[model samples]
Target: MRDDNASPDEPGTSTDRSGLSRRSFLTAAAALGLLPAGGRAFAEDKLLTFEKPRAFSFDLLADQARRMAMQPYIETKSRDPKVLDQIDFDAHWKIKYRPEATLEVADGSAPVRLFHLGRYFQLPVGIHVVDGDKSRELRYDPVVFEMPEDSPARKLPKDIGYAGLRVMAPDQKTDWLAFLGAAYFRSAGELNQYGLSARALAIDVAMPTPEEFPRFTDYYLERSTTPGHELVITCLIDSPRMTGVFRMDVGKHGPVVMDIDSRFFARDKIDRVGLAPLTSMFWFSETDRPDRIDWRPEVHDSDGLALWTGSNERIWRPLNNPPMVRTSSFADRGPKGFGLLQRDRSFANYQDDGVFYEKRPTVWIEPKGDWGAGEVQLVEIPTDDEIHDNIVVYWVSEKPVGRGDEIPLSYRLTWSKDEPHPAEVSTVTATRIGRGGIPGQPRPKGVMKFAIDFDGGYVAKLDRDAKGVEAVVNASRGELSNIECYSVKIGTAWRMTFDIKADDPEPVDLRAYLKSGDQTLTETWLYQFLPEPDSAA
Candidate 1:
């Protein structure tokens, strides 16, 4: 789940991590000329001072992680839990970082700011600045921030450390990226909205046993030579069962692009370890909407999971808000790529100007090298609203990892409005579900109807009236009938409608694709069907 400064009562609410309100802060900064056009130049008044340098490298960090894993894992406790409790949501908002204290790095390439420790984030992290092969630790100081006179944070120790850190624009007001709460981080993509989050690693997620969240104990921020272009960040992750090192090269061209290199060492055997895991919210969508659930037409950070297999087959699976926890796995060898995509880009589809669901970025995971045999796992947890993130997707290797095993992995993450590598075949545009039965006939108790839309690529060139175009569909445990396919009036898009007669209450797995003669013209569409509560009983 993506952690923000929101209170428990305001779960999933978007918060500005720059320690200030979004609109007022940006407007004021711009008016003062602190933020120039294109958001590239910074004021000369703020500069970062460096302490004595110490030698550092990636190998040294890996060695440190290995040594840490050899010893017993000790959990880091909060120094002042009572003080953090007093600095709750309301008080935390009142505390802000001093503008003059902003750390200007790489000669105004990107400004840096710190997040104060609060109830949601009790464990502090060590932060440092890197220059070439040398680095210096940045100590915590209460004078760097401005808090209300009555704020509980003022009473805390001067060296309490920071909860997290954020990378801001040259203005030091609008932040484009942040790392906070566990090994989790997110970026405001090309559209500048925070939705889904990417975690460093996930251990035993959705298993019978409790899940484990690792912590980023330390961070090293490197100075970039190119102004307003890129930044390098290295993190040391620690947990009870594992220790790891991560290096990320983040570029802010338009859509945020991150190249990640990670290595892990395990203290104990882990059967279920998720690499490059993504977490998002999926409360409701057009496919299955309860009566007047909310005012919005759809509410979700991402609508579908797209996969490109090694054999060159494309697949699209629409997301769901299931009644129970559900796990789906797609096995592959040397897979090309996969990601959770926000395919729907129309504002009318969401009708949410505040959150702008239509602008949520689609994050794609591209492997840097051959990732041997593994399966892409998708876990859907039951959620009544958008507050709780209910969707998680990750890649799990088939080979088991045991204690003392050293695992190295590398991948590139693209946070954009669309998939970086799109399929040449047709694509699934939308999915809709409703009651199954003839319009005038009595409705069937144990039946359902589905309408799937396919557009673009070869399908757009072929005439729908012409023969040979077929809807290849099948169900795992149901009778499929009354199939129909036609072109919609708006564009060259084709719609396929079908009904399923599910005599039993068991869940059904359905797959469909567009084919012309022996050639496949569209990517495969997969969906899961769960019977209504009354019918299931």
Candidate 2:
């Protein structure tokens, strides 16, 4: 590791660091009594105001959460909701955190910044700076933020606290990591584009009962002493049903990786609890591109859910823009890993350039220890527009959670262009559904055609003339026919075509794979097809 005490003029010290290494700089500052022990850091830095130092640690935070669960839960409220209501999306974006106020923490590294509260995000979240075991809370003041004279944010009180915080790139331009909304946080992964968000915890999600959103009410940030890890974040979450703590060690590699240690305590029994939940938008892709809804060829942050099972099997389940709410669960003993991936990288596929959907990062979750028996649950809610987040995936324990339950889990989140695991078998590249019968022929009623593409594994090297390539197919409610698989010829990709004859109102579970003799050549492609009315079957 580089010397933390190195001077700005030091040969190896980068200019962007501004001579301040977050860990050492803050440590040295606190030693000098930068501000009165309890008052604020504002005297030293106008952007920050701090409270007195308090002893803190990961275990302490978890213990506090457990204690909080034993007591009654209280909901967080805004100091002035009426004023915040005037600051809508347009007004919020107009308020910017001044560059001079950037918080320090990177390899000596990235600068950290604060976010302002607004209409959509009104609940104040306490932000703190941690130096060793002592942490100081940063008080909110309008001096750190800039806005126009007429901006409604100016009417907000000084102690409104921050809505969230983000870590900026060395260039002081783009933010690589951000914590915002409820328990939501996201990383601008390999491509440096923001997309999906991961939650600290999900309670009773996608159930008949209203989903509970646990708020990350407080944050403790410290510059990591570890070589690659840049920032350490501790979040205290509170909800009506539970209280929890999430400790994250965040770092940037080829992918942005967050090693998270989560502890949740329940005050009452939860019908369902989702761990490591990922949220994103999946309006429409090639599989079911509804006309008039969007002019873009495809629109979605992620198109498929990829899973690595404990049995050493791989499965690729394409996402769908269902007509109704859909929840699918894949059971497992100990899941190896899973993620929502945007495999289609071509810019032409997305068309519109404002927010590059093609560049949206893929987030994979790898359990650090045995997760035991659980299932990867995917809940896709119907959406007619791209504005709403409609896709959610998380791990749900087979064991039930009840009152006074304290659950601990650890996992690593990799935000990247692709999953961290090496691909040894061909993966589903594309999935398209359309009218069943052969093109130019009379379309068969109650029959839908399914075409899937696979590339980049054993199938790529297989002989084009190999007749042994069998398109093994199965469906829960329909007969599959016209099955065929062949090399596409342009790339290593191969295509599988088939038809499913299903008229049932329920979704049809279809599974398909390719193999030559005893060896499986591709990951299992599972599709939950929601049937449509058809005159012919």
Off by over 4 Å in 2: 1-43, 106-108, 439-441, 535-537
Candidate 1 ranges with C-alpha deviation above 4 Å = 1-51, 224-229, 535-537
Instruction: Encode model 1's per-residue lDDT on 1-537: one tens digit a residue.
Output: 232322212223332111111100010011000111122222222332335668888888899999998999999999999999887656766677766666655456566677778777788998777666777777677776777899999989988987777777665546667777788887777877777778799888888777878879998877544444567889999999999999888888788888899999999999799999888878889998888999899999889999998888999999988887888999999889999999999999998876788888899999989999999999888777766667889999998989998889999998898899988999999999888878999987767889999999878987868678889899998789888888777789988899987766667899999888999989999998877756543
Q: lDDT of each model, Cα atoms only?
A: 0.77, 0.77
lDDT of 2 by residue, 1-537 (tens): 111121111101001100011000010000000012222222346556678889989999899999999999877777899998887645666676666666664433556677777666788888887777888887777887778899998887767777777676666545667666778777778987777777788877777766777889999877776678878889999999999999999889679988999899999999889999987778898887877776889988889999999998999999988887888999998999999998899999998676688888999999988999999999888777665668889999999999999899999999999878957999998999888888788877788889999988999898777778889998987778899999997878889999988766678999999888999999999999887654333
RMSD of 2: 8.7
How do all models score by TM-score? 0.91, 0.90
